[model samples]
Target: MAPSLVAVDQLTVDVITDNVSDTYASKPPFAVSELANIMQAGAQEISGTTLLVANLGYGLRLTTRQGSKEHVLLFDTGTEGAAFLRNCRNLALDLGTVEEVAITHGHWDHMGALEAAVGAIVARRGQGNVTVNVNPGMFNERGVLLQNGTIFPAARVPTPAQLEAWGARVSNDGDARLLLDGHFYYSGEIPRVTSFETGREDHLCRRDNSEEWRPDPYLMDERMLVVNVRDLGLIVFSACSHAGIVNVCTEVRRLFPDIPIHAVMAACISAA
Candidate 1:
């Protein structure tokens, strides 16, 4: 069955080359042609039900859909990530038409260009309102482990109020008030549905001034955008599936038992 709604887009990743020159000293500088070649070399694309995964160098953009509404959820905006933003703008995909913006797991790479996304939406839609969903506590109190097991300070998590101050409606915690349909249908706490799904043990966050580090667990962070099409079945969109893909699938199945999963799109792999 064809879904009543469509999340149209693709994920593309590009490799950036930094050249070390006196003028561009921070990292490295590369000629426009060289950069273009690097970008062409590292590009990858994937398509699924509710997500259009695109890898723009340091970060990823998961464009989701629900009925006729569309939202572009960003994961890791990247540090000094203007190039990625520009790439998004230039892509065949239209960022101007997005309905909302969500930040997945606070980190500079994930949240840096949030303002840019808002601005682009404004430029395209003109003074329109949008929702920004995030779990600020993920960063406000904990740290995360990199691929090498090296611990890094958690990125400053932004509150819904903070995002609201910047003209966005932030959806924090497990609040479902901002949903277009106002239907709280997802199954309770993921990770509990499957044994393969396990939270990250090395990820920790600090609550007080003390040096104590608490496991991030990325609890509420497992949330994803689910779209139920009249005919096309179900589409699930994810940022970083820290909660485990199997668990996420289980939750989706539990929520919409009759809706077959037509596609699954994600950014990073918690457990493949």
Candidate 2:
């Protein structure tokens, strides 16, 4: 049987922390890209010192609406806490409105600001315990292997305890599930199914801080977020597709054969 559509009336994704943006370019349809951002922000002050900063990471603020009700979901936290918060403030994002957060993977570039982001959410909401989705496999120590057989460690991400201290209610599981009142679907551990798409092969990881390092090419812990729009079909958010963007889209299609993928966000080939 086909799964029922988790339909949403509207969806808007703000690229909170990406590697690039066309803010300075004279974008078509929207005259003066700078003014477009400023006008869209309303009363929020937009200035050179307070402009959004692009980082060598990926993050997004996804807002979905159905009639009067709205849901906000934070996908990934970017590479650095200062940059992530700075971008959020520049965009005038209300962290309290973020009902759920899905950390796409454990790589620092995607989750370095998890703690600070969760704390900001809690601070604005006047409480702790903001739910966050994660996979246990991503918590292991990871690194990249050099030609000399020595492994250079990757940036460390927050642990369950650290995230908890910052008011995050961690859900570290391996199964796929719905989020944001079923408006979004957080995928389970992705199954590598493509012939041409493998994974980042040089990435090495150890299950423990002092364990023997092994080839952790596939990054099995990474997950994707999917939202089915009213007319556009499925929109998938795959941050730093270490699993290959094609494989990610294929998996989404396999899960919801009826919902044609309309768009993909943060789909990138990770060299690190």
Candidate 3:
């Protein structure tokens, strides 16, 4: 049967179990069976709200209620191993059916399994079948050095050529063209309407031994996935929110002022 697109959620986070001395040394501890039970229980709690849970821990996969024949927008692929693949299999999800993989930044953890993930998708769909939309040169364009002198550049920033070679397309506008109808929309570059998010400093990227920090209004970190549900306002799924959550909410309000913010899930909190 042709797979119909459906919104579903599943648990993607995994409990680290292998090679940890602490976990391995415990009495009857690190039991895969026990851990699986606990994970299953936790998964049940959030299952109702999840559209499609991809294992961001390694790679990504998508599954829906109807069956495992749904498509997914993978954010990042985990490092090599059967861990990610096995997780998908356990969830009855197929990595070969990913519709898009959006790499939030150039961080190793985020894009580690990018090639593998793409290969899986290609194995299902013929060569040059899928499009991977990425922000063009976003990593090379900007960054910031924290007050503690720690530098944070744009992570996982892949060039257009690099993405194309992997059977994907790239865009810097942060707008991803939709392949399936009724998919969630992305709230592109957010507008800082409130004073709560202003005066953020940009990290310096040194090319020729010269260092400089400046005010970056663009704050390239401002991006989110917005889902406009019937009565639920806007549901936003965020990666590392370099731009404060408030800033992201404000931008959502600007574009969709009438919509209420139903929920927000993010990986990092902005120090700004």
Clashes of each: 19, 0, 18
lDDT tens digits, residues 200-257, model 3? Answer: 4544432222555344544563456655444445566665565677877767666666
Q: Which candidate, 1 or 2, would have the higher lDDT against the true structure?
A: 2
| Cα lDDT, all candidates | 0.51, 0.81, 0.50
Higher-scoring candidate on TM-score, 2 or 3: 2
* Runs with alpha carbons beyond 4 Å of true place in candidate 1: 1-81, 92-94, 123-128, 145-151, 181-191, 208-211
| lDDT of candidate 2 over 101-175, digit per residue (tens) | 899988998898887788889988755547889989988999998888888998778998887777778898999
**TM agreement with the true structure for every prediction:** 0.63, 0.91, 0.62
Residue 160 CA displacement from its true place in model 1, Å = 2.8
Q: For model 2, what is the alpha-carbon lDDT of residue 89?
A: 73
